[model samples]
Target: MLHIWGRLSSINVRKVVWAAQEVGVAFERTDAGASFGVVNTPQYLQLNPNAMVPVLQDGALTLWESNTIVRYLCARYAPGRLYPEPLAERFNTERWMDWQQTALNPAGRHAFLQLIRTPVELRQPELIRQSNDETEHLLAILDAQLGQHAFVAGAQFSMADIPVACELHRWFGLPQARLPHRHIERWYQTLRERQASQGVLDLVLS
Candidate 1:
């Protein structure tokens, strides 16, 4: 059986679980990392030397990095659909996935850390403000792109959407004022309505 090791509260872990659901795979998820505490164990360290929350085990294969795991699930199971078989379309999907990891996630991480994880007394306003500023600009760019297409890479939902939407779930769930991005809200609502998004998208951010 496919098994994922990480706490559900983690956005990265949520991506893998949601992808497994999207590809119609039966899998088990074990909580590890943060307060759950198994991530530092010798065995867990062997699986992911980075000591990150998300680690995927499928028979002999062990995978780290949430986006790579999502790509693997789609490529291994869903193929031309979620995996996007066409060369141009596949690269387009790959582009957005990398952007989410390198751009969007970094822009918003500090804000999420301050608002969601850190205590109010200890939260730094400047860090939150700066992170939010960068994230909103990126969100506007994403909004403009979504205005032209139904999904991030194209019209059909693909593996690309999983990581981006999970990041959105984190940013949007933050308790603060956000500028209106109508297209993002519209596309996100559509993603939330998908059956596979039930557990992943609906969870409260942590």
Candidate 2:
């Protein structure tokens, strides 16, 4: 059995859980990180020196990094469905997965931390504005891509969609500036309908 360590509320952890569900993988999840507090334990640190949530243990294989875990799960279990069969198609999907970590996540983190995590009196208005602006720009890019295709990589939903979809919940849930991307909104609606997403991603932002 695969063992996952992370708190359910964590976005990184949620990505792994969502991916596991997408591939119909049966696994055990142990609460850790944030309020749950197992991430800092000596045992947990040995598994992931970075002390991050979502360390996956599958028999002899131990994996860190949430996106890497997603890829591994799909590759080992779901294969052609979640990982994609063709080399070109897999890379195309992989690009967006990397893009989430490189681009969307940084911007989303800034905005989410400013608006949700930080106290209003202590919040940095200038930084908040900059973060919001950058997120909007990134979402606009996604809006354009979503317009051309049904999912991020194309019509079929793959592991690539999991990370960004978690981020999208934050973007749409927060009481911030309204986005003008009809296609992206439509895509989000579709994700909302998923049984796994409904249980995992459908929650009030913390």
Candidate 3:
């Protein structure tokens, strides 16, 4: 059986879990990181030297990095569908997935940290504003992209949608004012309707 290590509260872990669900994989998940505290253990270290959450172990192959884990699960279990079969299509999927990790997620992280994870008394307004500004601009770009297609990468839902949806899930949960992003909202509603997103997207932000 595939074994996953991380807490549900983690966005990274949630990505892996959601991908596994999308691919209809049977796996075991252990809670680690933050209050759970297994991430720093020597045993966990062998799986991920970065001492981060969301480590995937499949037989002798161990994987870290949430996006990579998502890609692997879909490519292995749902190829030609969630993983995409054509070379150009696969690269398109990869482009969006990479953008989520390297662009969208980072843009919104500080706001999430300040507004959700950090206590109100300790919050930094400037940092939150800066983060929000950066994130909003990116969200508009996503909205424009979604307006042209049914999903992030193409007409059907694929691995590309997972991380971007997770990023949106986190961003939308933040306590802040958001201008109505029609395309994003429409697309996100579709994602939420999927059975695979039940536990992963429905949960409240941490």
Better of 1 and 3 by lDDT: 1
- lDDT per residue for candidate 2 within 1-206, as digits (tens), equals 88999987788888898888877878899999888887888999999999998999999989999999999999999899889989999999999999999999898777788888988898888887888888889999998999999999998888888998988887777667775889998998898898867667787877
Query: Candidate 3, after superposition: displacement of residue 105 in Å?
Result: 0.8
As for candidate 2, its clashing pairs are none
Error of 3 at 80 (Å): 0.5
Per-residue lDDT for 110-169 in model 1, tens only? Answer: 999999989999999999999999998899899999999999998999999999999999
Q: Would you estimate the TM-scores of all the predictions?
A: 0.98, 0.96, 0.98
Kindly list the per-residue Cα lDDT of model 3 for residues 68-105, writing each as its tens digit: 99999999999999998899999999999999999998
Candidate 2 RMSD to the real structure: 1.1
Report, for all candidates in order, the number of backbone clashes: 0, 0, 0
Check candidate 3 and list the clashing pairs.
none
RMSD of 1: 0.7
**Model 2 TM-score on a 0 to 1 scale:** 0.96
